[model samples]
Target: MLIRSIRLAGFRNYTEAEIHPSDGVTVFTGNNAQGKTNILEAVYLCCTGRSHRTTHDKELIKNDHDFARVTVEADRADGMHDVEILLSRISRRRIKVAGNTVSKSGEMLGHITGVLFSPEDLRMVKDGPAERRRFVDMELSQLRPAYYYALQRYNRALKQRGALLRELINAPAASDTLDMWDAELAQSGQAIMTMRRDFIAKLSEQAGKTHEFVANGAEKMEVEYVPSVRAEESGEELRTRLEKELHRARQTDIRRQITSVGPHRDDVKILLNGLDARSFGSQGQVRTCALSMKLSELEIMKKESGEAPVLMLDDVMSELDPGRRRLLIRMLSGVQTLVTCTDIEDLAGADAGKIIRVHQATLQEA
Candidate 1:
């Protein structure tokens, strides 16, 4: 898949702009605060039906504007698709796919899938489990719509169960509701854990190879899905496991007013040469492992989707080392990529199809 073009209105600093990108790599170069990254943000909003930078819809709208709009024209193996996201300050965001309005953002999946590597991604290794979980959830949500809905159900059940647990501290009559929420959480959490297990197994394989290549075979990397509770593959068995674990943690949940067990508490462990990268690996090792995992998604997503997903590197070139940058350039073989940087020299040897300069939120071809 490729992003043929993107149009933005009242988005960030860009009052109005559009660009048709080349099939291969497209580089956006400019100084800081020039709206280079805003362009990539627009393309990514189409891919995932949300922004990577912020959660507030109003933040995307420019000053004195009540709404912001982003439209993406993408090419896939099947056909071309147009996705539009309209953000309003007073209401929820709306999405349209192929000229048809979609009630849920999850419905916009598969039309335009992408993998993004921002400067913040470098902290994936050392940051808390929340960031790692977001990475897994976003990717899986795009590839498997079923997983997306299941995750939604799981999150709702989790919230309800937590509320019930907190209420039990003062009013114990609501204890019966805990049983119902546990069943719901287990049913959905089981599905999430099963899919996450298989995904991590595949990811570990690809990341191992990529890490070897990126690290010059000096370090071995392994990615593991560490669920809060032991998980089983069979439906009945896994459901039972989740329910039992939830029951076991009910007292702790009530005391803390938090649902402490399930996929929500799970983590992705990155091991470098047999040591946990988060706790033991050096900074270089942590960054390399993170790089391997991100780059490995290119092949994994294609394998799952049957086509390459567009790549967006938002000012990550400046954060990555020369070797990692070179590895990234070599990996952009047939995939369409949008890279933003302050200077072109960051990607000195990259074969860019379009080199555009950004100034005052406008684009100019160089």
Candidate 2:
């Protein structure tokens, strides 16, 4: 539940770096471009297979290096664990736990659950539905390994079905093949939808309470999963519903050369007092809602994993006011937190205590 240390080699701006993180708040203080965020990125990559900064794995390696390695040590119930990720330019990335490779990436999750709060997260409310969907997917993936497995199956089936549909458009004789793919896609998609809806229901319950507290009981925010099809409705019912819609839009899908109906095109809606937050909420409201949602994620992880997860705060306090910053400090006081800030001195009391300075991609105990 706590990151004991992290070792990075040829990752971003850090050539060779090792950090011994404190169980309590550990601040990374440095100016811009001094590798403050890079350290946090390394930690994030170790937990999740991908990065928030970029999708390409090779971009994380050093300019001239062929690969990058990130190893994170954590303290768990049984004992300590070493989570390792090896990234290369030409080959598939490899993941190992305690020196043994794991063929499936979903197997690596939940070993070290972490919540990353970066400046970009503030846009969660204002951005398109894709960002919100990603938020739900990542949070659920960490909390429930089953969700990850189901999601993978659903996505794979979706891709194959789309390809079949594209081919059927050119040759009408392949209609029977399309029927088989439709059934498979529908079954997997239904399972995924069931998991997503249940997860979002739990998330909404926690997020509502967290948002009320963070907003000082002034505003109410709610999250809802608007699936394309309801689960209580039988698969036959779903197929009928989808068939009616797909028949109406067959020509459109052929023109676009993609599958038009399924879970892939669904979305989650966030409502603030009966109005959509993305289009109507003020800037302050949006940011606070996002923060509440993130904190709720920590709560969800704790309940699911039976321990607190590591916290990564990436240059977010700089924009928060003193009141909100104090609230964040209070919530994260006892948890392991890696925070990024330019000047810790500006933060009155909480910031001055337990600060570790970052200079030129290296960390030293303060």
Candidate 3:
């Protein structure tokens, strides 16, 4: 898939702007806080119907503005398509694809696939379990609509279960109240767990090869899905196990006023050369692993969707060393990429397909 062009209105610092990017590599050069990242964020929002930077849509709109708009013109294998997003402060955002209104946001996934790498992504390795879980969830959501649906159901059930747990603590209730949500939570959570395990297994295989290449075959990397309940089990087995676990943890959950056992408590463990990356890997190793995981996403998305996802590098080159930068540039072959940098000279000698300058929320071809 290729992003032909994008237009933004009242998004972040930009009042109005349009950019026509090349199909190969487009570079956005600007100083700090000059609306460079905002361009990439807009494209990402158009693709996934969610922002990678923030969950609140209100923050995407400009100050004192009622709404923000982003329109993306993309070319897929089938044909060209348009995706538009409207964000309002007072109401829910609206999403449209090919001029057709979409009531469910989940229906918009995979319309325009993309893989984004930024400085903040390093947290996938060093941060807590929630960050790693989000990494898997976001990528899987884009590739598999069923996964998105199951995830949505699981989250909703988990929330309702937790609320009931809190209520039970305040006023004692019959076990039937908890039993109803347990069955619902386990049914959806089982599907989520099964899909996540399969995805992690495949992701590990891909990321392992990427890590070996990026690390010059000096380190072997592996990704492990750590479920709070069970592993290597069928959906039925998982549901049975979750049912029992939830039953056993009932007293504890009621005391804590939270659902303590489910996919929400799952995690992804990254290991480098047989050691935990989060605990033992150096800064360079951690960054390389993170990059490998992201590049693997590009490959996985292509394999699943039969179209290579657009790659967006949000000023991550500035955070990498010369060797890592070369490794990254080498992997960009045959893929459309969008990169942001502070100075044009910083990307000197790199295969910058098309270079544009962003100044004060305005864009100019260079």
lDDT of each: 0.87, 0.79, 0.88
Which 10 residues in a row give candidate 1 its minimum summed lDDT?
282-291
lDDT score of residue 31 within candidate 1: 88
Q: What's the TM for model 1?
A: 0.97
Error of 3 at 237 (Å): 1.9
Residue pairs in candidate 3 whose N, alpha carbon or C atoms collide under 3 angstroms? none
Ranking by lDDT: 3, 1, 2
TM-scores, all candidates, are 0.97, 0.92, 0.97
Cα RMSD for candidate 1?
1.3
Tens digits of lDDT, candidate 3, 1-366: 888989999999999999888888899998899999999999988877778899999899999789999999889999988889999999888988898889888877888888998888889999999999999889988888888898888888788888888788878766697898899888888888998999999999999999888887888999999999876786788899889899999999899888888988999999998789999989888888998999998999989888899999898777777777777788888899999999776676578778898999989898
Write down the lDDT that model 2 would get: 0.79
Candidates 2 and 3 compared: the better one by lDDT is: 3
Per-residue lDDT for 1-366 in model 1, tens only?
A: 888889999989888999999899999998899998888888878877767888878888987888899999988888998899998888888899998999887888878888888877767888999989988988888888999999999999988887787789998777788999999999999999998998889999999998888887888899998998886564889999899989999888898999989999999999988888999988777777777887788779998778999888888777768987787788888999999989799988899999999999889999
lDDT of 3: 0.88
Q: Local error of candidate 2 at 269, Å?
A: 1.6
